[model samples]
Target: MGTAAVSIEHLGYRYPRQSNIFTDLNLQIEAGERFGIFGPNGAGKTTLMHCMTGLLSFQQGKLSLFGNDIATNKKETNKLFGFVPQDFSFYQELSPVQNLEFFGAWCGLNKQAIKQRTTELLEILGLADVRNKQVQKFSGGMKRRVNLAIGVIHDPRILFLDEPTVGVDIQTRNAIINYLKELNKSGTTLIYTSHQLSEAEELCNKIALIEAGEIIAHNTLDNLLSEHKEDGLEGLYLNLTGKAYRDGNV
Candidate 1:
């Protein structure tokens, strides 16, 4: 059998002077799967993604990508995955082409490669017309597209997305979703987290529902719905995690 795209065993994490964030967490995601991690505010969904991507340190457990231990092979493992955070990661003053050029270089691409990729992404993501405009002047949907383009600039084998389509028009949302689907079809494993349950249902083939830092449910979307007797992800989520308004930093 081939190695899993991502694997975590006995993971534990907590901030200083706080209660445990999560403990004994374990998960495995195979390649070429659109995997969604869904949870309410402050449920540690983002934190878990951070741990997987090495953005935050964890106190215990092991993380691996494609069978290589992350701790021991941080550089090697890092090259295989890309993270598109919720916030804008590019410099606001830079044009999209300039931003892509800088990030592409950071990702170790040659100048020619960077130019080609920048052109391709701009065209495919509908940013070609505004390629030279500063990102700060773009709309939210345009900014989100820029965020996505940067994340995949290196053409990573595994892509991690946190609230990728949080605030955007339906047209932009559809565009991003369709592009993500294309990435998956081309063999990029996707690990995503979001509060948009309906969108999650549409994008993910596999689902893991987290609550209070614990994975309460994990299965294929169809199997989860059928087994829990819930018609949709929202129903399953509310049924399991409760409908009370969760108060925490999103």
Candidate 2:
């Protein structure tokens, strides 16, 4: 079998002056699969992404990206994935073209290649007309598109998205989803987390539902649906986590 796109084993983590954030977490995301992680606000989904991408450290267990251990091969592993964080990670002052050029250079793409990709992404993401305008001045949806464009500048094999379509117009959301579908269709693996269960249902073939830092369930969407006898992800989540509202930092 091919090496998994991402693999985590017996993972454990804790925050300063707090109890364990998660313990005994384990998952494997195969290549070409759209994998989703769903949970309440503080379920540690984003934290897990940080650990997988080397943004944060954990106390125990192991994570690997395409067979490269993140703990021991950080740089090599980083080259295998792209991450779109929940918050905007790019400079607000920079124009879309400039931001893409800078990030493309950081990804080691030559000048011509950067220009080509910048133009293509701008057009494909519907930002061509505003490519020269400062991102801070753009609408929420436009900024979201810019964020997505930056994450995909290098076209990495795997993409990690954290609530990527949040707070956007339906048009922009659809555009983003369509682009992501095209990417996954072309064999780019996806690791997605969001409160948008309906969207997740449409996007992910496999999922791991987490609560209180524990994986309550994990499997293919079809299998999970059958096992839980739930018609939708939202129903399954409610069945598993109850109806209480959760509060935590995004």
Candidate 1 backbone collisions, by pair: none
What are the lDDT scores of the predictions, listed in order?
0.93, 0.92
Q: What's model 2's lDDT at 219?
A: 97
Our tally of clashes for model 1 stands at 0
Find the candidate with the highest TM-score and give its number. 1
Q: Candidate 1's residue-wise lDDT over 40-100, tens digit each?
A: 8899998899999988889999999999888788889889998899999999899999999
Candidate 2 has which clashing residue pairs, if any? Answer: none
TM-score of 1: 0.98
lDDT of candidate 1 vs native?
Answer: 0.93
List the candidates' TM-scores in order. 0.98, 0.97
